[model samples]
Target chain A: MSTVREMLVELTGTPEFADGISDDADLSASGIDSGDLVRLVLLIEQRTGAEVTAEDMDQLTTIADYERFVATRGGAAAQPNGS
Target chain B: MWLTQLAERNRQCFPDRTALVDEHRSVTWAEFDDRTGRLARGLAGLGIRRGDRVAVLSLDRVEVMETYFALARLGALFVPLNHSLTPAEVTGIAQRTGAVAVIGEAALLDRHPDLPVRLRIAMESEEFAALGADGIALPELPDLPDDTPVAILHTSATTGQAKGVTVDHASFRAIALGWLAVARPADDMVLVNCCPLYHGSMVVSLTYMAAGATVVLMPGFKPQTALAAIEKHRATHIWLVPQMLRFLLQAKAMESTDLSTLREVLYGASPMPVDIYTEAAARLGCGFRQVYGMTEVGGPFVTLGPEEHPAPDAVPDLIPAGRVVPGMSARALDDKGEEAAPGTIGEIVVRGPGVMRGYWDDDEATAEITVDGWIRTGDLGYIDRGGLIHLVDRSKDLIIRAGQNVYPTEIERALRTHPAVHDAAVIGTPDPDYGEVPLAYVVADEGTGTAELLRHVAEQLAPYKRPRRIEFIDQVPRNPAGKIVKKLLRG
Candidate 1:
């Protein structure tokens, strides 16, 4: 099972795109566009059964924020593949 | 007296009333008018003049609306660039339009450093903020004629290039009056517009504002954000695409969202699935209006009003595109260019005061799409006995993914650029989420793989335009004249 960080990295289509990126960096500024953000939210929901609310979207501006969100929602723990 | 006077009239009538709202701030009608005047003067100080073309690229924001009104005040043509386009595509459009100036967000401007424009204004720069400063005097605004072109909206071409649709002040004014007559919006209407301001759908926002309604603009459409906005602002009306409506329906927020204030939901750009429409209508307890039109014509000349919507439990019938609005006329023409009888499917064409002036600088292409004064809609439809337009299919092989147009020829052209790709054909396949998604059939050289082709196309096209799946085929079936037979491929 891929971690939240791994899924975030995969969204960029290459690891180098997310490499050296700070946890506090704005994902939109770091090449994650609005479309990608929507797709990421959908992916997290499908994989972890976690709900990202409208309030959460306003605060989820950085990678660290998203990671913290998933962890709090009980999605950070690894599960079996295709679970 | 179309756009410029509309702003002035709003200020005069309701100075304290909120005119525009975005995530950052809300502006009153008076403040909005004052800002537009100052920005127009600032742009004039930078050498922008009447009749000059200026390209604007930005996400949905109050500044985008300000720039549009500012340019319209000066009688300059506002050319809105789709933010999703590659740098090369942006450059191509900027060059073709002979744009003299470009204004956009700092980040978006950074991506297109080589755009063929004499001046660039970053919306977030200190200079940009100073554009609306108090000291600069407002320039003498142009007294634009009704026929003066105000905007150039680009539509993806069948030939893989983009064509600019030139629309004049009169076209918009006609559309506004016609829509007002049909919609009869109340003075207290508060609308949450989900469509991006760059596209032709901006007309909806502009038209609502002309009637002194408050419009809330989102940077982009997120289902949760949209639902929250509707509740927060007590929005009386909302406009979005059908796919967006689907997302909003599925959003977790929908369960707790207060939607009692929503009076109407306007959807367009693509057909609304019957099941989704029925479910949404029942749940939201709001009327649904389906607007139908194209960029080549003005935004929307036909509408399926809420009264015309079928009962939820009734046997589902084909939902018509609706009756033509005031100031517009439509008919179906047979292959021989004669008007088809009622109930006969044929190429739908429309004539109206809102029809676009012409394609920018392409008389031949413009002539091809226009028959007499009517614009060919490229949709196959027929008028029923009740005078409603019922669409059967699209004559053009254009794929609409989630509300954005994805031209198959453009994708095919990008595929052919790959070294190993011999030939490619693309078609639209139905999807439960997005109305349709592109499926590609490829004839490639030995050892070529889907990943390689997908990567190559990714570099050339936007994310939405990319193919969902590629199937290796022996050959792309074509006629003796070398025209691709997409029907066979669909089978």
Candidate 2:
């Protein structure tokens, strides 16, 4: 299982995602299309052991918001190091 | 009002000047017009009639010149079939259009190809031998209206069955006039052409030749041969697709070749990125024009001006599809059929002389898009305050959720922006409750885990626009014409 940030980091293959970029950055405003976001949703489902319905897809607004949803929905617990 | 007017006017003005060149072969206006008159008679002798359809299928040769002009003279429709398409496809088009004759040389008949045309004949290798053997009286062209049907071009059938688009003399005249207003074909300029004669760009070039510039044609798009010809003949101009531009830009002698003779390069048939355009402009050393048009409307209705290229303001503004030339008008309309405000997304509607008469024999579909006289292009996008058209996607490919429109193009654009995503396609999937939701298929440049993707984009999109499902594929399914085949994915 991988953290939401880790999953985002993997699909985007950007180290900044792994390290962390602002969750509020506009994904489209940041240049991400719904296609890339869809891949991200699939990654969340696989890593977090969560069933993400298409209806559930709309509830997410930012990386932090998504991570919290995954956490509440029993997504992967973060690594031992808080950092 | 007539196709012959283009050549006739030019022949009167430049009769002794070479009007066409191919493989060291050149045809002057005087010779082309005089012989084409006889060839029209030859075709008429073989029963090609006014408003008849003649299908030309062969390697690029001198006879094609005679074929085009002969048909133009008689007001018969000329159907240029792609030599690269499968024989079955050829047969299907021939059957659908009910062509009067399918003319080929010895090589094209090698596979014992069967066509649904009324007659089939193979011309000799010399091409001109037919003229010497049987001298037929040149048939005087009949008086025909510009609105008269001149050609029946088949739609690419990228998504489904091919439909014939009726191009009238008005449409042809409008296209040539509008293009010349910008391309400004030089009478003495040697135009090197390699696109298949069936394609719209090739036909446009034919009109340019008909306008009197010497035409240098190729059998087909062959990169090596194109380079050789450019070098050997000093071809002054070339028309190509973006893919061809990329290749031409890479030719070994591109920079060093005595390209001083080269004057302009015309490219269309697909959307191109800004970077590619910039590179091509700098390297090719010619004015670049982007053409945008569909089969229903006379092609290339809009083009981005040459001044827009590689400029600082080119971003988002330099749409390769230039502004609509004079006489034609464009409006972006929403689903309800009302005009969209500037920068608002909607389907594009066009009206002008260039608009096709209608889809040949498909009245039901014709009535659906064409209303009054405006052709409703299923393409979705917006017009800026300056009146430039920006394409988003076909209206059929739109995904609606809770009454909100989610354009797949916007989503696909987002996906391509990702560092790892090489390509992406977003389509609407059936939703029991909401009626539909978007599903995305991605092709990635590198192996990546899903968690990182979720973290990066989960917060970036609105709830309705988000993709509920995702899948990775080796490559998107595209038809022979390189357009993504979403219908196949739904199947």
Best by lDDT: 1
Local accuracy of candidate 1 as per-residue lDDT tens digits, B252-275: 678888999999999999888988
Off by over 4 Å in 2: A1-83, B125-128, B131-140, B185-187, B312-320, B396-491
Model 2 CAPRI rating: incorrect
B-chain TM-score, candidate 1: 0.98
Chain A TM-score, candidate 2?
Answer: 0.68
Tell me the lDDT of model 2 at B199.
60
**Candidate 2 lDDT, A2-83, residue by residue in tens:** 3667776665545544454577654433434333454565455545555554235446667776877777974364333422
Instruction: Supply DockQ values for each candidate.
Output: 0.33, 0.01
Tens-digit lDDT string for candidate 2 (B147-192)? 7788887654322345678888888788778767866656667777
Number of the top-ranking candidate, with TM-score as the measure: 1
